[model samples]
Target chain A: MRLFDFFKLSRRGPTSADTAKQRLQVLVALDRKGGGGPDFLPLMQKELLEVIRKYVEIEEERVNVDFQAGTGFSTLEVNIELPSETAKMAV
Target chain B: MRLFDFFKLSRRGPTSADTAKQRLQVLVALDRKGGGGPDFLPLMQKELLEVIRKYVEIEEERVNVDFQAGTGFSTLEVNIELPSETAKMAV
Candidate 1:
């Protein structure tokens, strides 16, 4: 094997950038499939809340679902804040 | 607490949709900051490849850095295919 190839083979695993890239691919693919915004966002959010409710306490404002459309593509962005560990213990 | 509030307090955790939303938010934020296409994409790719090369045997074709600009927003998509476990073992 070439010297550089050997070095490459001995290297560690994926980096944060790799993880980010993989994630972006999935998100972009989903965005493409959904096209602008998924009509089921509210229903999806309701169901999502129900599922999350099983674990930690979160405020409604802590969860957000939004769609951003550019020229040729649109993205669906969701943000949910989890309760802190201390907050969880109090519950 | 109200009946529903009590129930909401006893939830589980974020769902896949929740995760997607969080990830999308970051990606979108990055996209927005980059503004359509980052002029440094080529340089960024070169540096990214160098870093990734330290870990795996990946071809140039396997690493794709693309910008898709829509009407209002743009997305920078990066795709990298690492050497398969079997392929790595063979090396």
Candidate 2:
């Protein structure tokens, strides 16, 4: 199923998943830029913060980025908590 | 928008993105495991592959995992083609 389908099937509804998914989509598109390097987590972290700052005011300490390698696949996770008041507007 | 909301607002249907979103969501959850680390791209890549392998067959070369840091946010993208045919069924 596509993310939309999952949303339709979801008991929680798509509106709820939108923010997270939007963030994820943007994140994934950027991560695909790596070209045969050790890993771009550090670079990604730096650049990601730069991008977010351009669009939104944020707290530097709250942003995070990482890669997790699994047996069949690997995952990258980026966590960000904008200023509480800002997050509410985003919500 | 949440993932589900994006699906509804999407120009293309979520069914197509479902495979990608499902993959990304799984990847993100896994990536959240890192704690005070240099970067877990390698470990995330390994563990992700292992998890995918347990459920489905895949081409090792096709699987990708990385972190992309932006100004305010960062993202991880994992791309995997599950043996072509398997990807179809998942669809």
Candidate 3:
């Protein structure tokens, strides 16, 4: 290693920027490899519907759970549509 | 410039890793400065409640919109509780 390279390493193991870079690298790699944002969504949606059914009567089709990645934030949205009086009393 | 440095620079303006690094740097920098997320959440929540209320009867207090950060993916969670029949028809 050159003197500058040696000095830079000697200063510290890794700066915050380096740590952040490594994390981002891992995230990008995982995303590209078809990873992340899985293994829990469908399960979560099922459980959520079960819980909502306790207090209100709604069909599985009325519940939606979505996970999406934003600029710097990821979003998990749960939208549950309660049945209207007529809809609930239909059957 | 050193021969190795000159060669690396002449190779390309920025590799994918470099671009990833720069993007990660910006994200971290914005996070440290308390600038990563904001400016659209409250508005979104308000609009969401308004839309939901049009079809169903739901109050704003029962809606929760949360923003959080995690290992590599941040999360924005929205949970809304629809009013049960008894509650809606109470008054």
Give the DockQ (2 decimals) of all models.
0.02, 0.04, 0.03
Candidate with the larger TM-score of 1 and 2? 2
What lDDT is reached at residue B23 by model 1?
A: 16
In the range A51-86, model 2's lDDT, one tens digit per residue, is 445434466566666555433333344555443223
Residue-by-residue lDDT tens digits, candidate 1, A4-27: 222233234766543322111112
Top-TM-score structure, candidate number: 2
* lDDT tens per residue, model 1, B1-91: 1212221232236565433221111111111222233232223334434433443356766555665444323334454433323112121
Interface RMSD values for the candidates, listed in order?
A: 21.4, 15.2, 22.3
TM-score of chain B of each: 0.41, 0.45, 0.36
Stretches of model 3 off by over 4 angstroms after superposition: A1-91, B1-39, B69-74, B85-91
Better of 1 and 3 by TM-score: 1
Q: How far is A77's C-alpha from truth in model 3 (Å)?
A: 8.7
Q: If both were scored by TM-score, which would come out higher, candidate 2 or candidate 3?
A: 2
Q: Which stretches of candidate 2 lie over 4 Å from their true place?
A: A1-91, B4-26, B29-37, B70-74, B84-91
Q: How should the candidates be ordered by lDDT, best one leading? A: 2, 1, 3
| TM-score, every prediction | 0.27, 0.31, 0.24
Task: Write one digit per residue (lDDT tens) for candidate 3, span A1-91.
Answer: 1222322322336554444321110001001111222222223334433433443355566555555443322333344433332112111
